[model samples]
Target chain A: METKELQEIASLLRFEAVRMVYEGGDGHPGPALSSADIVTALYFDILKIDPANPDWADRDRFILSKGHACPIWYAALNERGYFQPKVEHFHLRQLHSEFQGHPSMKNTRGIDMTTGSLGNGIAIGAGMAIAAKATGKDYYTYVICGDGELQEGLCWEGANMAAGRGLDNLIVFIDKNGYQSYKTVDYTVGRNNPAERFMAFGWDVQEIDGHNFDEIKAAVAAAKQNKGKPSCIVCNCVKGKGVSYMENNNNWHKGVPTKEQFALAARELRGISL
Target chain B: MRAFSGSREAFAAALLDMAEYDERVMVISADSLKAMRAVPFGEQYPNRYVECGIAEQCAVDVAAGMASCGLIPFVGTYCGFLTMRACEQLRTFIGYTHLNAKFVGFNAGLLGGEREGVTHQFYEDIGIVATMPGIQIFTPADPAQCYHAIRMAAEVEGPVYVRAGSGREVSVYGNDAPFATSGITVWKRYGTDALLLSNGFVLDRVLAAAELLSQREIHVTVADINILYGDDASEILREMAAANLVVTVEDHNINGGLGSYISKLACENRPVRVHRIALTSYGESGPANELADAYGFSPEAIAQAVAAARTQQ
Candidate 1:
């Protein structure tokens, strides 16, 4: 797919995600918006997955380890026809809905694993990669982790194991959206470079602009070309990308925008900033 | 299934059988390959065996990862480390996700103190995992039962936590010991004066105590329960109703174990006096017999508790 096409889909997804947060009256829009572009690239171009037969044994596995940012994931899955739903019409966090506040493998079809709690998806994703090796399957496992999610001790423990095992089949993309749940990742943990840590842990590391479609595609291509070790693409992202007021704003981490604010966010996503 | 010197070896034996029949069955150890007597399994199928090198949380999440795919991974490690250190990891990844995985917790109780010290021993494991839904808690009696329990756990579709003893656990059951995926087992039947309920390797002493009580004319009905939680309440409730009083014996802490579990049931359902004989404090490093004596779980101690149950009622 062309970069322009991917960018258009991503903008649509960002608007849809923000609208879900507004309609649901509760959600983390910051994460959802931040992860939109890369999420779009994976669902639209990168991932080798069959939407009709989601349980295919050889499907490339994708785990949203930073699960709170799942509105973007849901929008992409809905757009890719993983399930029957008009992406703009469905309730976001409704009770018993397939698309819960966070992703649940038991509930959703395209969801490879359940995640809401931080630091779990990466480790679980590593396991899936190891499984690919065990079964001699060509399917790669992609994991999207939050930079703030790195504060969890288990993430490092998992990284060490995956690196030691030389899980070249695994590719981790750190959504470096600066702001975390409470504050900025740099302010909360002191040191901010997730790429350096991944390098120290022996993973093949790369840094890229998360919202850039070309950067995401190139980074993924480089990750696949590289061998013998796992890859970590630290994606520098705005907390709320594309939207005028919400971009780089931490207050949007978990909130529903007003009618006027929501209208403005939607317009900005359509390249009609007014 | 033949009994080995310990429950861990017997469990490993059963794991080997599981792996032989099913190509997807694998072992994930936290640097306890030698401790679990799984060096043989590792040697036989190096591709299937994953040694995470002393990280319990890492091993468990990795096993969850493998389970998410088509593989069934058995994680072998110390009970406390697996239960305490990686409690959240187990609850979220394996428990809430309802993954098809088996956790073989070695050094389950104060009896594990004989191996190392209190650090290796875990008396609070049953209590901890009992709260997590979808996790089947199997506290098998001995090596023979551990063998069957591991086999049964492998058959379970979701998360199953089978607690095993350290390498020195004595085999009380015969080669063909009866094991349940979920239910209680009657180890012996003398009378309904008292129901002797116990789980884990301490069942050896519990059976002996039942024998001594029978000889003393204090006749009690002894039962060994493998499923600590998530059992059909009817059979156990029937056994509880048959007895005048229930005597709980285990090599675990006084709270959150068989004693506490049964007491909760008895208090709510049956009108019977409950007598608990379990570890009162953290485990002490010593010989198994001495630790048993010190913690009030010796054969004589269990028998005396049964005898004294008449006064409590």
Candidate 2:
């Protein structure tokens, strides 16, 4: 759980995520790589979970609302001992693979809810939090959603409910990578700040450097400390975090990387700063 | 003929009965507690009631989430909003996962919310909900069937969509009548010349149509298709094959409703000629009975359609 070890895990997750996209022939590598650090921190440093007992009643729930970046989640889960790292782990998006293009609760391990459609995770997580509150369980629910997913109206519907009901046990992280499907989120939508939007919806909002482990840990800790309101941590991130050529490139959002690009991404994630 | 009684009251009574025994039974509404007659349930089990306040999509996804954690959440809302407004959430969150969520679509079909115009009245929900795989669609006739269908929904696991009709209910079966888990329930078997299939409040019209046909010396088999989806179909198919003609009557649109299902079943299994007496177009604002009559779902209209089919045969 040291900073260096967490950094190492994040790098490895990035490498695995890139490699999975490369092997699978089709995936959102940009989003996956962008969320590598946040996912790594949650699995390794933050979330209270048991890989052997994914359905433990007292375990904290994690929902990846931005589900296209599931390769990052799969990588983190594999490294956290949820499942053994196998050659097939790289067979993401292939027919019948446990790692689907999007997170499937039925197919994936350690996934509490199936979320492919945008804006659903917030409500589902709120439901979990409400269940915990109603049942006298104290387990927290953590949801990681993409900034682009904010365009979906259903997200606010859930967000409004969560805040209205005072779901303090819920914590959400918006991966503000700026890019959506084809272009920047601001270019596609307006330059709306997620911090202001969630705050206006009665959430406890905070801005953080998404790739910075210290800020990520501190923000989550701060969110946990706050009471009587659901928390939203806006993590500003690069489209592709660890790779040089794929960084901020929208075309790399889905296309499988060439052999040279894959090798270059792998080398960069293996301790190269650039 | 008995007076028309709304099924929403029966649904509320059944929901309250279930909530009394099962602690997991909770109701989530889009601010439709009064419309759904779930006030008593809310008052008795205040902790179990959730008011989502007009956000149907959030209500459904919230129910899906609650179901994930071992709670049976029933969503109560108007059929128009519940089926279309929150359809994506239903399809992805509840239907895809087959969550233990029950959706009671109050005010279903063209006869539902007659004065509310096309905005509130939905005649296309059955078809839309039928497209979602693994979600059982239940269309109940009379208050007794409504009670039984809701009770079944609470006891059954996975996703269940109960198409609870609006006000203006008719008694098709007695309170003590047994509920069928699959296939159609035969209420009046006059003859095998035609298989008359109908459900929900429209069954009353179909029954009256049968009586009118009997006056014309045309005896027909009258069966209420209480269970819409997940039927074993062997018994229903046998009943269909026995008849030379099959006439399906409903208060819903012809496409993707009971008529379409029966027609497909007959064409595939029995090869019988099928005639559908249903709303082929959208509903407009009017009195419920007047709308029903104009939409070609009245007793006289159904009888005429059946007589015409008989002549063709």
Candidate 3:
């Protein structure tokens, strides 16, 4: 797909995520909006998955390790035709909604693994990669982890094991949005260089603008081409990318927006239907 | 249908058979292959076995990962380390998500160690694991039950915690004993003045107590509760209600173990007098038999408890 088309999809995903949060009365829109471009790039272009057959054995696997941002993931899945992309599909965090607060493999059609707790996705992705190797399958496993989620000790365990085993089939993207739950990532957890850490763990590391389609595509291509090591793409991103009022605002991490704020954000994210 | 001399040996043999049956069956252990006696399985299918060096938390998460990919991964380690150290990881990834991960907790209770002390002994494992919803917990009494339990757990969907022993256990039941997917196994029954519920290697002691009680004219029924927390507690409850007193004996802490579980059942359904005989304190380092005797789980101790319960009634 062209850069323009990817960008269009990214905007639509961001819009749908906001609409889900807005309609559902509450959700973590910050991370959801932040992950829009990366999710859009993977679902629309990079990932080798069939919407009709979510359980295709030979298909590439993707795990959302930072699972609270599932609104964007649900949006991507919906637009990809895993389910109908209707306005009613925006009932994200409802009691019986298949689109739960977190990604559940049993509940969602396109989800490969159930992930809600931070730091689990990377290891599970590594497990799938290990399984692929064991079964002699040639499918790549992609995992998107949040910068805040890296604070968990288990992520390092998976990373260490992935590198030790030389899992070239595994590729990870860390959404390096500076804002975390309470404060900025650096202020909350110090300026921990994920790229340097990945490099030290014997992973091929790349730094890129997360919102940029070209960078994401290039980084993914580079990760695929690289062998004998897992790749980590540290995507420097704004917490709320498109919304003017919500950008870099930690308070928007999770909340139901006011009617005025929702209208303003909808106008900003033009061409997105509610 | 073959049985080994010990539960751990039987467990290892069962794992080998399971691996042979299903290519998806994999084993991940925390660098205790020799201790678990899983060296044969590891050596034969090198790719299927993962020796996750002494990291219980990492091993469990790794197993959870393996389970996610349509593979039946059994994680084995010492009971204390596997339950205490990796508890959160187990609860979150395996328990909460309802993953098909099998946990083989070796050497539960005072049977685990001599040199390692309380760190290796886990009388609190059953209590900790029992709280998790939809988790299948089984404490196999002997080698036959252990072999059958492993095969059954592999066949069952969702998380299964099989508590195996390190002690040289006398056979509670022959190979003919029915190993149902869930529920209690009545080994021997007499006049049901008191129902004796026991599990693990400790069932031998409970049976011995029953024999000693009979000599004293205190007839008690002995049953091995292999399935700890299954759907049908109805059978066990009915037996408990029939008896004048219910006595639960386990090689676990009295707080949240089988004793506590039975006591709760008695309070709710039977309203019968319940006596819980289990370890009251952290265990000390000694030989396994000596530890059992010291901790009031010996045949003499159990018989004394039965006599005390008869007096109370």
TM-score of each: 0.97, 0.97, 0.95
Which TM-score value belongs to model 2?
0.97
Once fitted onto the true fold, the runs of candidate 3 whose alpha carbons sit more than 4 angstroms away are A85-89, A271-274, B1-3, B168-171, B175-178
> Which residue pairs show collisions in model 2?
none
Candidate with more favorable, higher lDDT: 1 or 3: 1
Tens-digit per-residue lDDT, B1-313, candidate 2? 1222468888788877777778888889789999998898889888788877779999998898889888998898898799999999999889889899999998887777787888888888889999999899888887788888888888778899988878676777787666688658987999987889986788888899999999988899999887775747777887887899999998888899898888878777768899888887787999889988888987888989999998998
Model 1 chain B weakest 10-residue run by lDDT:
B1-10
Model 1: residues with Cα > 4 Å off, grouped in runs: A271-274, B1-3, B267-269
DockQ of each: 0.78, 0.77, 0.55
Clashing pairs in 1: none
Better candidate number, 2 or 3, judged by TM-score = 2
For candidate 2 chain A, which ten residues in a row score worst on lDDT? A81-90
Candidate 2 structure quality by residue, lDDT tens digits, A139-206: 88999999999999989998999998899999999999999998899898878599999999999999
Candidate 2 chain B: minimum summed lDDT over ten consecutive residues — where? B1-10
Candidate 1 lDDT by residue in tens digits, B1-313: 4336678888778878778789889999889888898888999999999878778888988998899898999998888898899899899889988999999888778787574778777888888998999998888888888888888888878999988888566677886866864468887888888898887888888888889988898888888878886657678888999888898888888898888889888888887788888878887688877877777887888888788877767
